[model samples]
Target chain A: MKIIAVCGMGIGTSVLLKMNAEKVLRQLGIDATVDATSVAIARESRDAQIILTTPDLVDQLQGLPSEIVPIEHFFDLEEITAKLSASLL
Target chain B: MASPKQLSNYPALAKAFADNSIRVGAIALDREHAIEMAGELLVASGRSTPEYTQSMLDAVAENGPYIVIAPGIALAHGRPSEAVLEIGLSLVTLAEPVVFGSEANDPVRLVLGLCATDHNSHIDIMAELATVLGDAESVNTVLNAVDSDQIRLLF
Candidate 1:
């Protein structure tokens, strides 16, 4: 599966999430490609299956094909995993 | 690196400084600009000056990801000596995202502006804010909030 982690700058926290998600995916034995980008760039890149970001920016996505997983806390691994698992299916 | 325990001190910090504070309008344009704007509020509320604001940015820039703690939130702060008259904190949310550096996962939407009189005090508040922000649900509540009053309710 392909996943895109998005924020305002396409750096910083989104990259951190990508790193954490990579570790989590590895532990779960899930083979998924994760990329990070800004919301603007994410809008342009349509190859991902899921988009992860804060709930505030989730509403900004007016029309998009990817399913958005609004992440409130970037440090909550369990919550992030739970949300990811639910969305991936 | 302070543990989550160290981060739980944000509430007292908030309570201590919330009085006599003014809430500003939300910036819908650039997220990075929100950080600066929030910092300005923090400085103004604390009766600080421009030097303090520059110092805050410098501290964050040197320290790396001080503000971009979580996903969408960025807590911009600096050493208290830079321009702190008193301890202060402020919250700013962007209607849109703004880029910071070149991290594959940045463009922060929420900025929690902070200013402390010293490093010790700053660490305490940082710890608390970190803990509070670690919760997905709580972070969502803050992010989805419409006004400063609503944002204050979360703290």
Candidate 2:
């Protein structure tokens, strides 16, 4: 599975999201590749099966083929676990 | 399962904060001022040039307040640029929370400024940070820290 973790600049928070998501995926025994990118780039990623991002950026990414998962708290693993499990597992 | 304590989990981040990069109970008039204060610490630490500070502010202007990563925290940063000299971090805890215009996560009390010369250099530090910030109990401890020394002890 391919996933994209997106933030505005793609350097800071998205990287955090990507790393934590990878950790969660590993713990859950799910296999997936997560990429961190800017919203502009994420909009163009047609192959992404899931896109994890903050709740606010969800509107801008409207109509993308990937499942847009709105992450309210980027740092919270429990939240990430529940959200990702609901969507992926 | 219980969340692991943040003790000694972020050695690099602890060292970065030890280099006079942390300010506790600071006052900032607005979100911009808060971000500038965090960036200034990075500049003082020689991790980035003064221009990098403006780049961070510009990033907020262009991208909105997505930096407000959690309910009461903002991780201020811009892309790696010529202005960045090395990988570093600066932390500022505010006397009064400042709103960054995010409805979900507004009135940020903690601002963490990060600058890296490359994409991969700061990833580990950020990962450590994610763990530290993820737990509300840990976040509360940091938020209520009396001094920089107290904050340093957690890492």
Best by TM-score: 2
DockQ-based class of model 2: medium
Q: lDDT by residue for model 1 over A24-44, one digit each (tens)?
A: 678677899778666678888
How would you encode candidate 1's per-residue C-alpha lDDT over B83-123 as one tens digit per residue?
Answer: 67777777776766777542534777777666666534444
The best candidate in terms of lDDT: 2
Mind giving the per-residue lDDT tens digits that candidate 2 earns over A1-89? 89999988788999999989999999999999898999889887799999999877888788999999988778778899999999987
Cα lDDT tens digits for candidate 2, B1-155: 53433346777677556358888999999999999999999999888998999999998898788888889899999889999988888999999989899888998999999997776777778878888888788788889987887787777
TM-scores for candidates 1 onward, in order:
0.54, 0.92
**Candidate with best DockQ:** 2
Q: Evaluated on chain B only, what is the TM-score of candidate 1? A: 0.76
| DockQ (CA atoms), all models | 0.09, 0.65
Instruction: Kindly give the stretch of ten consecutive residues in candidate 1 chain B with the minimal lDDT sum.
Output: B16-25
